[model samples]
Target: MFNLIRKDVIALKYYFLFIAAYAVMFGLFTVSSFSPLMICMLPAIMMTLFASNLELRNKSMLFIGSLPVRRKQIVLAKYGSVFVYLALGIILAAAIRAINEYGLGVEFPLTSLNLSLSAALAMAFAALYYPIQFWLGVRNSSFISFLVIFLAAALIGGIGNMADSLTFDMLPTRAQLVIGLPIAGLLLLYVSYRISLNLFLRKDIEG
Candidate 1:
């Protein structure tokens, strides 16, 4: 599992470049808002690149599938890697927030209800995005098609003020959401793993 996470982080080198760029922009803007938004992209980027195609291309899945490891292990390892990334992002963001507030005199909260909510948003994204990656194994047209659809929907929503119209405030408060998101994420991940296991067992690891 550790090795799998190591491989995942290694594959994320390029993704970190985007993260670095986001960091610079946040500093320029002197706002933590964008910072959390950027970190929330972790799952999307990871799924699109590493989780989706990686296991298949690298044959890690095949190798693991051949071993005594259960499908749950594979799913759990992927979730574990994302959690590590999320933790790292949170820590780094907090550090930067501290520096910006203390050193730069930028007003950013060390801990905020907003940040808490954003973190939950990150989990939701992670929870929803990964199973497609796990099951499709990257090169499958289904994943690509869904990716396109999701992007298009987002773009169209952006153009149409759908975000503004949405009643987002009705959801749980930040504190509650923070606790709820991971529980929801874990449930979704388990469901996804079960689906993936059924599919994998019914299909071909080498196919």
Candidate 2:
């Protein structure tokens, strides 16, 4: 499991990506709050899906299945790798936000909430993509699936905001954005994992 996790982590070109994402976050998005981090998550999701795709493409699943490990363990490790990567991204975002606040001496607005929200979104987005990649083989379904997911998120968010004023405002901003959003995102991740595992078990491991 440790080796599998390490392999998954190393397989992703994270350093170069971090440099690119960091540049955007610092140069253009230094002051902007959620948009930059939200936008950056798009790539993180793609990279994570691609990492899983690599294993699929290279026929690692068969080898993995032949081992003594349980199928759930393999799925969990993949999910765990996504989590570690997302955690790293959140840390970087926070560190960059701190630098911007300290260097410019301006507080990063919505610091904790935004960072947590971004981490949660990134994690869930990555997880959600995996089942599509697995079930549809990443070749056929990924383009349409990703397109629909993007559009759906945009539409839902827009609609939610539009109704926000009229909707009963029960939770504080800190609770809603900081705590609730992540919990919701985690539900998405859990669904993704279950669906992906079922798909993998039912379909050919050669995939």
Candidate 3:
């Protein structure tokens, strides 16, 4: 299982580098907002599906599918890789936030919101996405993923705007939403994994 996860990391090495470049570019020259944190998160949300697309193209899935591994393990490994990228994004965001706050001596906006928002975004995307990818395969999943992300971004942005108009006392405590969203997101991800695991197993049997 660990090796399967490692294989994905190895295969996506260059893509990860590209994400680093993206982080640096967005980090250095950004409006101080949740946008930077959200942008940094896009890579994590995109990579698992991207890696699966690459595997499908290269016929690596055929090789991987032929292995002694279980279908559930394959799904789990893919889900695990999402966190690996999430961690990468968090580290990049933290470093960028540090540079913006300390090194530049500029007060960065949303510093308090960065980590939790990143986690919430990543987990939200993962929870919503993985089942679709597993059920539809990469090609079919791509469009829906894009559509969902777009809609979600709009909804979240609207909610943020609304929240901004309220006094701090009226807002859900940042502590509450930040913590609750990720917990809920993780539960959703687990449910998604179960659904995907079942789908993968059926596919494996049919194949």
Best by TM-score: 3
Better of 1 and 3 by TM-score: 3
Ranking by TM-score: 3, 2, 1
- TM-score of decoy 2: 0.75
- Per-residue accuracy of model 2 over 34-122 as CA lDDT, tens digit each: 54465435445655656755775676777776889877777777777776766655555556556666776755553567666676767
Instruction: Assess every candidate by TM-score.
Output: 0.68, 0.75, 0.84
lDDT of each: 0.58, 0.65, 0.74
For candidate 3, write residues 1-207 as lDDT tens digits. 899989988889888887877777777776456546765577787686678667766767778877898887888988888789888877777777788778988665544456667677787777777777667776565576686688668867987899889996787887787788677768877887898888888774222
Q: Using lDDT as the measure, what is the rank order of every candidate, best first? A: 3, 2, 1
RMSD of 1: 4.5
* Model 2 weakest lDDT span, ten residues long: 34-43
**Residue 123, candidate 2: C-alpha displacement in angstroms:** 3.5
The alpha-carbon lDDT assigned to residue 170 of candidate 2 equals 57
Query: RMSD of each candidate?
Result: 4.5, 3.4, 2.9
**Model 1 poorest 10 in a row by lDDT:** 40-49
- What lDDT is obtained when candidate 1 is compared to the true structure? 0.58
Predicted candidate 1 versus true structure: per-residue lDDT over 1-207, tens digit per residue: 777677777876776777666665664464755555454444344444444455556656666667776655666676677667666666656666777878888776545554454454455455555555545654573565467447545744673585466587754576775577566656665675566556555555552
Candidate 3, position 141, lDDT: 53
Model 3 RMSD to the real structure?
2.9
Candidate 3 lDDT trough over 10 residues, lowest sum: 106-115
Clashing pairs in 2: none
